[model samples]
Target: MKQPLRLHTPRLILRDFQREDSEAVLAYQSKPAYLEHYERPAPTREEARAFVDMLCRWAEEQPRAKYQLAITLDGGQVMGTCGVRKAAPGDTVAEYGCELDPACWKHGYALEASRHLLTWSFETLGVRKLFALTRPQNLSAIRLAEALGFHRVEDGRYELTCP
Candidate 1:
């Protein structure tokens, strides 16, 4: 709901994206592993800048429908982004997901950040259900979803209902 929005876990902070985060985002986004399942080509510097600007703009909305945050270590080096977004203000359901730098993969950062995002979405945002749409071949994402207590609702769709 504000510029400095943040959610915390034991090992990380999920904070609002800042302009300075553009370069880090670009660097990770350029990796072959990161792009493996994505259809779009790697982003240019200007595209990355615009993307961060858009996240900042979304944060400024009156009844924010999205929380696209930067995932950072406690020491403040950003590793990736995570988000839970409703289709409209006051919706009881949202879509959520996270991505980390390829180098950070398998280290549990995505799991840690996603667990915190799920909690924040359910508690702070009043969301009753959170769903993730992962690519069919993204086995790591599938495993992470299952590990977090999300059940497969349908092909490519996994869901976690609030307790």
Candidate 2:
């Protein structure tokens, strides 16, 4: 099956990553607020390019193991990213991750984009289970996951089992 490059919601579009998005992504992730909960330091532009390139490669591979979609406003401004990566062998699960521009916080974009991905995971990818991990102190992310119907499965881990 061909993986869709763009998913539409009322207010956002989750589309494929592009070189042009590097600057916008860097603008958000480079901030201290955005990187505070991340274990690694904020990435430089070069690092972001390398990261995007890797994601693009994965998206192109057959039996794609990752879906790295750029979260954009309806007007097409790069606002964040939302995607899923294959879980490790024996896990039979996939992990979801997202990062949004601080300027776009509190607008429900994360939850909307997450719901879209969860639907794709279950209906399109035929994934049986999905999960996410976030810093416990990151209340916003935690709330967003819960709102997307992912329950707390363990410390820093939330899960949604397909019905």
- Estimate every model's Cα lDDT from 0 to 1: 0.89, 0.83
Off by over 4 Å in 1: 1-3
The clash count of every prediction, one per candidate, is 0, 0
Judged by lDDT, which candidate is best? 1
Q: Output the lDDT of residue 78, model 1.
A: 77
Error of 1 at 136 (Å): 0.8
- Where does the lowest 10-residue lDDT sum fall in candidate 2? 84-93
TM-score of 1: 0.95
User: Model 2, range 1-163, lDDT digits (tens) per residue?
Assistant: 4564888988888888877678777788888888887888889899988887777777777767788789988848788889888854334578889888888898888889989888887887777888899899999989898888889989899998886
Q: Best candidate per TM-score, number?
A: 1
lDDT of 1 at 127: 95
Stretches off by above 4 angstroms in model 2 are: 1-4, 87-92
